[model samples]
Target: MRIALLSYSTKPRGGVVHTLALAEALAALGEDVTVWTLGRGGDEGFFRAVDPAVHLRIVPFPDGPQNEGVGPRIIRSIAVLRDAFDPVAAKYDIVHAQDCISANAVLPSGRCIRTVHHLDQFTTPELAACHERAIVEPDAHVCVSRSVADELARGWGIKAEVIPNGVAYERFADTDPAARRAWKQRLGHYILTVGGIEPRKGSLDLLEAYALLRTKHPDPALVIAGGETLFDYRDYRARWEARAQELGVQPIVLGPVPDDDLPPLVAAADAFAFPSVKEGFGLAAMEALAAGTPLVVRDLPVLREVFADAARFAATPATLAEQLSAALTAADPRRQTAGRRLAAQHTWTEAARRHLDFYRRAGQR
Candidate 1:
């Protein structure tokens, strides 16, 4: 089988990560897989290295002039990617798009499969249009969680196949002790969250929670890691900064942690915080579980569906703070063991087999 997996950017966003991982997994199954993505800002490769077996096509997407409106930029993005991708569409047995932008780029041909990682309520007119078309135009749909699949059904009477995300369990579970020790030495005892400060990530809420948490545990620091994104969040970031100052919370903001050092950073953390307002699957939190780190995630339907009892949940900042404090002080070894087992059960090989099954079925349809 030949597959072309499409994603919008080469950044460290969840969907891009999924695209690369799934491509490698599919290649391991003796399938011809090529990953396609826009090389935004001259990025010649992915945030991390990919398996040599999978082919890559990074289309050049240069940044537009300063003060370009979001709407025009989005339209231009679709145009550039679509023009770059159309010539290569016929080479693959399956052209699966991983996000709205990539899905939109492929939709003109009307012969693409799309993975709806999650549904979002977009207020911008262009984004709203892109989101809707991506959902409705794809020949077949895939979702990472049943919660998101259900959202598609409720919103548009669309039925999507559910395939859970696979975690790189051993990479995190067997982190180098020296690397872990080095991170611990640098950051000290801390709580960590990836994905940066954005509105959707509940950055302000986490800040509030961190402030409350400091009342009891002032020694353990709050560290934010990976944060490379395409969206504009300056207003939200400014608000977060103001709140942090008001709360007297000084978090160690290590933006875009090096890919090689991420596992050890996750491993060394006292607990991992995933207080996102929305999510398809809590991939970072799952990686933390793989590393035997206690995790606290927001109480969302998707998270509840994915995590169940393997993690602690909170709805509000105060409750989030409470959960973090408890997770820091009294993490149960039994839960940690269960988490490790759960992470082990979700392997890329299993995910790949299921994806192949889906591709065959969708092709027949």
Candidate 2:
């Protein structure tokens, strides 16, 4: 089958990760797959090396004025990708879009298979329109978790196919001891969270939780990595920094760690914290679990549906702090083993096979 996967950016966001890994898995299964994405900030390729079997088509998307609002940027993004992708949009057997921008771009190509990773509430007219069109315009929809699928059903009256994300189980689970030790030596006993400083990531809430955790246990430091985002969050970050100063806590902000260093970084952590307010699937948290790291996540329905008993859940900042403390101090080999087993079970091959079946069924329609 000829499949073309579309994504909004070439960055290391969760949806982009899904695109590259799924493309590789599909290619491995004797399917011809190509990934289409915008190369933001002059990027010519993805954050990491992709599989040789899967083809790449990176459309150049230049940066706008530094002060340009998100609405205009989103409009420009759709225009650039749509112009580049429209000519070849009809050539693929499946035109699957991974995000709102990509889905909006290829929405006019007659048929679209959109993966609603998560829904966002937008106020800007252009963004809200883009979000709604991406949700309802697609011929078929796919969601990464059953909770999100249920949301589509209840809110939009759309029955999206439920397809959970697959993690790189062996890559994280097999980190070398020396590499893990190197990270541990550099940052002694830290609580780590990825996905940069953004509102949806609940960065402010995490900051408060970390401060509370320090009141009782001052041994563990807070380490934050991976904050590459297209949206402007300087205000939110400033608030976070101001709050950090007010609380007399300094979190090590490592913005966008190299791809190779991610696994060891996850492995060396005393505990991994995921305080996202909205998430279709907790991909980074799952990676931490694969590395045999204790996990503490916000009590969200999607996370509960996905992580199940493998993670400790917390609803409030105080509860989150408590959970992090417990994760750092307690040694529950049983939950650790369960986490590893859960991560191992969500393989890309199985995901690709299910996607192929979905494509075949959708094509019949």
Candidate 3:
């Protein structure tokens, strides 16, 4: 089948990573999948980073200032949608939108399906309106987790199919001892947390918890890895660092690492800690499990669904620290083995098969 995967922002974020993985898997299964994106004129390095097997089409826009105002941003987005859809919509059998925000303006024609990563938690009236419109109008909606689906049904009265995110397992199988040793020398015996520095990600809470743990384990460093420039959430990292200093905790913040470097970085961790307030699907935690690193994550519904009995769950950062400490001190070979086995089952190939099945069924309706 010919499919068009539509996304507004195709940066190397979690959602974009998921989209690219699924697209690559679908192409491997002998499907014609083309990714449609807004052409953000850079060195095109990011697009080159994606697997060459998957097809890509960048819809162009007129030249303008580096950063446009809100009004111009909306106008430019509309222009991009028009340009993308004019030539491609009739040729493809299916169009799968990657996010509700992008789907809001593009899916009203009833020619596409939307996958809701999560609802907009922004308090802005315009953002809320856009989210409501997308939630109510999609031909069909797919959610990344059951918790997300439930929230949509409860709050917006929309029933969405739940499909969990999948990982590229083979990437984490091999180890590089030299790389690990270099990272270890830079940040010794550190507790790792991977995600963008944001308030909802619990970066501040992690600092608080690390402070509490420092009295007993004075030298165990905390490493924060992910993109540093979160446009809306830029203050979160500064606030966290200030708090860490005040509490006298050993905190090292390493901004985003490359995709190829992620596996070794995750594997090198003494233990992985995820103190997020919420998640549609905890991809980093899953990666940790595949790397055979012990996990300490928030005891939330979605996390429970993903890790089940394989991970140690804690509700608060203090509890998270305690659980991580215990896991690090007395490593369980059986649990690590079981976690790796479970992680193996959640491969991108399987996720792509499920997505294809859903697309076929949805198209028939």
Best by lDDT: 2
Clash-forming residue pairs, model 2 = 196-226, 196-227
TM-score of 1: 0.98
User: Which of candidates 1 and 3 is the stronger one according to lDDT?
Assistant: 1
Q: Which parts of model 3 have CA positions greater than 4 angstroms off? A: 39-48, 60-82, 228-230
How would the candidate models be sorted by lDDT, starting from the highest?
A: 2, 1, 3
What are the C-alpha RMSDs, in order, of all predicted structures?
0.9, 0.8, 2.5
Cα displacement (angstroms), candidate 2, residue 139, comes to 0.2
Q: For candidate 3, list the clashing residue pairs, or say none.
A: none
Candidate 2 lDDT at 289 equals 93
What digit string (tens of lDDT, one per residue) describes model 2 on residues 1-365? 88999999888889899999999999999999999999988999999999999999999988789788999999999999999989988889999999999999999776999999998998888999999999998999999999999999999999999988999999999998999999989999899999999999999999999999998899899999998887878989999999999999999999998899999999999999999999999999999999999999999999999999999999999999999989978799999999999999999999999999999999999
- Report the C-alpha lDDT of model 1 over 1-365, residue by residue, as the tens digit: 99989998898888988889999999999999999888988899999999999999999998898987777778888989899888878877898999999989987755899999888898889988999999998999999999999999999999999999999999999999999999999999999999999988999999999999999898999999878887788888999998898888899999987788999999999999999988998889999999999999999999998888889999999999999999988959888988899889888888899999999999998
Write the number of the candidate with greater lDDT, choosing between 2 and 3. 2
Question: Candidate 1, after superposition: displacement of residue 183 in Å?
Answer: 0.8
lDDT of 3 by residue, 239-266 (tens): 8767777887767777778767788888
